[model samples]
Target: MNSPVALFQELVQAGPPADAAVHFDTACVLGGSIAGLLAARVLSDRARRVVIIEPDDLPVDPGPRTGVPQDRQVHTLLPAGHQWLERWVPGITKDAQDRGASLVGPDQALTAVNGVPLAADGEDHHLLAIGRPLLETLIRQHITSIPNVSVLKARASGLQYRDDEVSAVRYVTTTRADGDEQVLQADFVVDAMGRSSRLSHWLGDAGYDVPRLERLEAPINYASARFDRPETTAELKISGVLELFTPDYPSHGVSVAAANAIEGQQWLVMLMGYGDNRPGRTMEEFRSACAQLPEIFAEVTAGAVRGGVVTYHQAESRRRHFSGLSRFPARLVSMGDAVASFNPVYGQGMSSAALHASCLAAYLGSDADLDQAAHAFFDLQQVVVDAAWAISAGGDTARLDAESGAQVPEDIRQQRWAMNQITAATVLDADIARAFNYVTFMLRHPATLADPDLLARAVTVNEAARVTR
Candidate 1:
């Protein structure tokens, strides 16, 4: 059997199957969010029929739904995520851009980590900055356009098992007064139900042990609002991000300015806080929070027209240890936030989901046994989860000593310090900035920051900054 990495490479190169060749009879995906949509698209290539079970009536236009509370929040697709999405759904980025999404290169954006401005010379990665709702809507449209994929408006209640393998999904339609229940039989089932997933309970009901959960308590809050972009600020061109996270100041915030999907000149500004420092609900309070942020945010919102304020709170980042389970049911797999959810501040959730979709596609494309494929998929998915978990949870650990428990090892602490120093030195050296940007954009692993040559340059730059100060 080809290794997961080798299979993924082959899958990416070969692209989707030439025709709708059926490898499975039926595949059902629980949840119609980005993760499920992506999974359905991949499953459509292998299954004769694909069904996505979602609770809410999906929007025809880019609009908010009660199911996705964070739909209104600012979302940026890392370069790696954008690449996978483009590969899976060809011309997706172009479709989004045609609808008002902006493709921003590294040089085009104003970015400041801690308080130092990142040097702009060596940034080659470009990001898609669009509203989350619009992105999801576009993906849903694409997935439903596939010949074999269909979405049902129903809530997934449980899984029906024949012995150890899941055979069908039990669901109840939301439209009925009595809530009539239905069963959809499938050869494969995927849980893409986000953080609110009940896969553990369903597994336990099927006589399987529930996976243990690993959590990092970050306790973050966000207050955001859209605003009319000042015509004078057009010269800034790219979006602006101001992130301040340090050991001394555990209370950190981020401000992002991006073009709205409907209105090109309008932008959304989000203000976030860590721990007990929450952003205000009123427009004045939101602006006050922005004022306390870096100078760039304050200037952007100084005379800008305000929109309605929205607030969200996240208590922890969680990962289900599904890969560690000794015995797992066959024909069942979990993806997206159902398996792992990260702190939203890091913007890793959607991108990580895209990577998981890629892994699923690789596994389905191979000739691996169905039962063994579950294990292989979990193992490969963990690789994606760990990379994102380390960045999000490790970042929280670096800011608050109280949150930095045994889960954060000593080596990770040292690595975080090295990365912080490198970020600080980016203000002086553009090469260091470019290397750091690569890690941030998920194009490369965090281990790249510790390269001997890069570390040496970081040390020299830090020493020069120290002398200048």
Candidate 2:
């Protein structure tokens, strides 16, 4: 008899007694980052008030905000991410395209996998690569457009909790005229503060100890440059996409046209690392990285119409192990980079965030409890993110397996064998390719490849291809 949204509102507003409405009136989001804003947007429906706190002064025009350094960088919403965004924001993808965002077909752009060129058969897979800041600007505007959300320019200095539950969000924020300390009370608190979350320290302050933490370095470095699209190239108005390497070379590059309008019309070239290799920023080094695959990257840039070098750094793959924790707060949740960060080379961050947001919507729609929601969220997120990571890291694992004293142990050989088949099969069979594309796009589960019928098809098809090769 009641709407899903209405039921979710009731659940969020209710007390520990679950069925009783304790009247949760306020919620605060840390960092005003993408994740934070999305969380605020969702919470706004239930809370009497919602505030978005950020350390930097937000601009009136869409530009890079100080908070997210990756803002100026290139970001892509994989199909999985696209579907997830549609669920939460609804029509935002269309808005992005209408507002000058280019939509390219899956194989339309340059993408190389496993040393072989992905045939741009001109169908199915699609990628929406835009500047991070541009995408963030659109999302920020949408959040502001929402009726009950407000933005606050403040850096969350710390957090406060009571009765083993998050009680308040503390911050030291600066305004146009002055700066001051603030403590906003709420029935819920969300740490959407990106990879720099202080939830661990905040928990310690409240006398809670972190049970488990696992952090590893992918040792990735990013160097980007903007170049002029070749005038001779007729696809100027086309969604220009470029790529290098196939499968696990542990490195790749992307050359995407500007999102909307950058004062100057140009395309962006971003080269990045996965296991240990990094994208070089210098014109020479950058060209060298592109040179590895002279068929597309270097050749296209050779005729590039315009832009210059801009290099950056990101090293590390982290997971908070929050799901393994025995106790956690309800109504209080997180998504995006706040949960896990991937090797940026894959451009899976936004999509992973979107998938997580979709989880929130799914859990809210059902009668799942807080614990159930958190667990379900992470479980699903692991698939979305790890699918991309596996492909990215699987390449690394290949190199490791080839060398002596590899970091990955021998316990997962069987798993790796199956993955190898899937990899080989996708290259030969369109059926396998479609299945693989679905996983890469976050459209299907990674385990889908393991299906007996599908795996048999992959094996049969790949075996035939090998004889021809």
Q: Which candidate is the best by lDDT?
A: 1
Looking at candidate 2, the ten consecutive residues that score lowest on lDDT are: 255-264
- Per-residue lDDT tens digits for candidate 2, residues 1-469, read 4433333223222221223222347778876766776666566665678888887777756676667877666677776666545555767777777665656665345444544644343346567656666677778888878887898777787776665566778777675355566788876667788887777776666665452544554565666666664446435444545453544453343322222222234456666554445556578877776676544565445645354666667666665666545565455566677777776655667766655555554444445554322555455444444555665565555644655455555657666777778767765766777777666666655556667787788778878877887
lDDT of 1 by residue, 1-469 (tens): 5453344333334346666456788999999998899899889988999999999978798889988998887777887778778888998889988987777776566666565667875646767878788899999998899989999999999988876778899999999789778899988999999998999987877768788988888887777777766668756665645465454543334433223222355577777777776776789887776666666666556545646888889899999987857667888899999999988877788878887887787677656688542887787777778777877887777767645445567887677778777877877898898887766676666656778798789889999889988
RMSD of each: 3.1, 6.0
By TM-score, who's the top model here? 1
TM-score of each: 0.91, 0.82
Off by over 4 Å in 2: 1-23, 119-125, 176-180, 230-264, 274-278, 299-307, 327-331, 365-398, 404-411
lDDT of model 2 at residue 176? 33
What TM-score does structure 1 among the candidates reach? 0.91
Lowest lDDT sum, 10 consecutive residues, model 1, at: 254-263
Could you tell me how far off, in angstroms, the CA of residue 436 lies in candidate 2 after the best superposition? 0.5
